[model samples]
Target: MILRVLLISLFLFFSLQSSAFSLEPVYSLQDCINIALKKNPEILASKATVNKSFFKIGEARSGYFPQIDLSLGYQRSYLENKIGEEYSKQYSAQMSLSQTLFDFGKTSKQVEIQQQFYKATEWQDRDTVLQTIYSVKESYYSMLKAKKQKETAQEVLKQAQRHLDLAKGFYEVGLKPKIEVTKAEVELSNAKLNLITAEKQLSQALLNLKVAMGAVDMPDFDIKDEDYAVRKLNENEAIQIAIERNPQLQAIKFNKQASISTKELVKKEYFPTFTGSASYGYLNEDFPLDKRWTVFFQMSLPLFSGWSTTYRLKQAESDIVYYSSKEDSLRQQITSQIKNLFVQLKEASQKIETLKIALKQAKENLDLAMGRYEVGIGSSIEVVDAIVLFEQTNTQYWQAIYDYNVTYAQIQKTVGWVE
Candidate 1:
């Protein structure tokens, strides 16, 4: 009795563990977006670029503080004369400090340029995030669509098999022709083929979703069946939100500001600069022998630099104009995108309604035909045709559903909001 009880306990333990491991992981839309944003390599690379730009801010600020340097040197010299020859060794250590007394706001302008550039980089990172989120949504919805298609195919196959069996029964009893059995068998074969194709497509879609989420090697998983509804939204309001919050537009604005600061920085190069320096030194024949200190002040003016500075200033000014034009172009593009997606969303919603009605009619037609055949008043071809019509309408309805959800996701991305 004890041995039997121990075996039972071990079996129960293993069964529980197996059930735990076999549980299907289901991800919602938000879950997929979050995973892509957190783990996608492209998104991470863009983040690294933003960090590198942030470091430039510190580099630009370094010019505002005093600069210091220390150096050590050893020198050996031999002198020969008519009377005698002598050899001497000298060792020197020196420390120097230099401070910018004034530069007409040159360093400040440089710092401002770096700050603006960093802001642009930050916005670029946000844009990358938005793009990744959109991609995840696209893949997620596609996987859902494929799964639905596969389910529909399986249902159609089962119905076709039943019809083939019925046709065989009728022919064997001398109530139907052999051609009816052949037709039903052909239909069943077609349905089976479609189901096989749908299964392959579903597997491919699952792989695509995993790739989009950067979980390429993850175990087989499923997505939650979410019924996405179309929400009423004012088109003008959406455009306004896009203008205000779109990261690509914001990045462009920052780039223009940085260009202006760069022009100022370049123009400042024409003005004179003043610097003050002090140095303390020790010089000895062998060890510590003598100590000395020196101080100096210097001023420099760029009388000419082969016209390079002037060209640089012109280039900076041109960049400011270029970025401004780019901002305008981007605004136009964004507005057009919002309008187009809004129209598509509306169309998809309408299509879904139309397809739903057609699907209802198709089902009714299939039922009527089946009932007529059971009562010996209808032909088998009519029933098969009705079945095909019903399947087509059903597939169309699901396609419309997937299209609406995809368009909604794009609209959200265009407006620069995804949570």
Candidate 2:
């Protein structure tokens, strides 16, 4: 009975685990950002690059530590002569240790260079995170826009169906022409086709959002829609923030510092390097031991290396200049981007206001047209024209809203706002 109970318990546990794995999770915008940060392959790779920089530091610091080596060997030799063959056997053990006494600060400068490189890598990782956040915001907003568009299309289809029904009823009563019914049917067919297209667009948007989230499969869930308000911002202040806080710029700054350190390290090559070494050896012939020890200090100076040292120093100096120029270029680019996005955001906000008023007028026109047609005072074409105008205005209004939201996201990205 106990064995049977154990088997049932195991089966139940496995069944629950499987169900959990198969369940789809609904995600908010923040949830998507967090998941991408945790699962995106590129983000993980950038993190690993940061880790590699740490190991490089350890490698650089190894120059300050002592190095030791040991060796053991046995040899046998036989010589043939007229009297007889004489045999000789030898055994040896050797050990050596070397340490850098000084190199005019060469080792220390190398360590400093590696430290700067690590800093640069850390900033690069932060930049990766910022980029991921931007991508998630874009895809999330796009999905929301697609959903709104689909809803608009469905409403238009319903309006078309109502028009069709009214025309058919009038024709049955001998109050409308056959051509009106045919036109209504044509409009209904067109509305249905548009709705189908809208649905396909929504599906594609959902797939894009899932890809941005780094999800293995698309989940079935509703996204929470929230109204976005236009916020006031200062362009000059935004540009200042980007220059001071942008991770890409900061990474380039670190790279420049590393290059400077490398240049200093190359200059040290002009001075002599001092290294101390010691060795101990023991040798035996026929089991008799002869022991020896030796110690020495060596200094090395580059008499000439085909001007390689000079060329290396020049290369490091060029790197410093290159990074400095890149920094200048990036700052200019940030300024231009902020200015451009600010204008677009403002224009979109104004457009939304105009579309709101237009939408109101279009709805009123549709209502008037429908009332006239119901009273047999207006033609079906008037009602149909009003609907087309209303649908167009409605789509334009939603599109303006989408444009505003996307422009705001671009501004946030330019200013290096991670959230």
Candidate 3:
């Protein structure tokens, strides 16, 4: 009895532990968006890039400090003709430091380059955040749509079951034909099959949303939304906003400025550089940096290196031109995308309204056909036609909503608010 009690207690303990850390049965789409932004792999990757950029800035700043080096070595040498050996081994140590007193602004330009690179990485991180948020939103809405579809299918199954029972009652009383009973059975069977399909699809959509939230082993959670529909975009306003506020454009502009810095660095190479170097050494006879103290100062000049420096400067100028072209091309592309998004947004609004009206018409048609069939005045063909039309309208509305959502995501992506 004690062992049994212990086992039960252990099981309860583990169950409670599991429940505490496991995914909750409830989550709002907003919660999912927050979780994805914090944990998504793309955001992690961008964070790493930002760290890398930080190290690069450090590398550029390292030049600001004077370089210092130390050396220690031993050597032995003999003369061709010697009186008691011309050379002898000795201990040595030396230290030298270098400072860039002047380099025609090369150091400053390099620092600027790294700073721009850091900004670019920050923009990339923001882009990743936007992308993760939008992706989660899309998946969240998809799951909501699937859940509703399953609910609708279940309702249809219940309706078909009711109709089937009504048909059997009528047949027993000799009020309905045999064909009507068969038709009702067939419809109930189809409805059951549709419910099964919808349930499977809904289950998969839920899993996808969980994956987006970075909760692969999460428990099942239902999607709840009062309405899933596209909000119309202000066509011209959106275009203007995209033009001014897009991060991609800002990123490209920063890149162009970095290119200009590169050109300035290259132009600086034409001028002379001045650096201060100092070395201190301790040396012995025929040895390097040994016992006796020594000190030296150095100032070096780059007389010429063929035409390499000139060609390199030209290359830098060419790069500036190249990046300028890419910037303009990207600008044109973003503009076109903004315009296209506006057009699609407008089109989707009209389609949704029209589909809503069509759905109402289809429902009326089904009701009329059912009433006729009940009075022995309607054909099986009419009933089937009504069913088909209603389902078609049902599927059309979901598809339209899906298309609208996808297009809106594309618009956000163009604006660099979505990756």
| TM-score per model over all chains | 0.92, 0.87, 0.80
Model 3 agreement with the true structure over 1-419: per-residue lDDT tens digits:
99999999999999999988785466787778777877777788889999999899889988889999999867776675645546556677788887888777788889999999788778767777776777787787788778767776775676567567767877899887898789989998999999999989888898888777777776677655736466656766766776666767667777778878887887777777777777787877553333444344554556788988788878777777877887788778888887887787777777878988998998898788877766757666677677768777877777667667767877876676543
TM-score of 1: 0.92
Model 2 lowest lDDT segment of ten: 215-224
Which candidate should be chosen as best, given TM-score against the real structure? 1
lDDT of each candidate versus the true structure: 0.90, 0.88, 0.76
1-419 in candidate 2: lDDT tens per residue?
Answer: 99999999999999999998887665787888888998877799999999999899999999999999998989999999999999998999999999999998888898999999999999899888888788888888888888887887898888889888999999999999999999999999999998999899888888887777777574565576858788888989998998987888889999999999999999999999999999999989856669989999998988989999999999999999999999999989988988999899899999999989999999999889988888889888899899899889987888888888888877777677887
Q: Give per-residue CA lDDT, model 1, range 340-385, as digits (tens).
A: 9988999999999999899899989988987787666788889899
Ranking by TM-score: 1, 2, 3
Task: State residue 293's C-alpha deviation in candidate 2, in Å.
Answer: 3.2
Residue 404, model 3: lDDT of 75
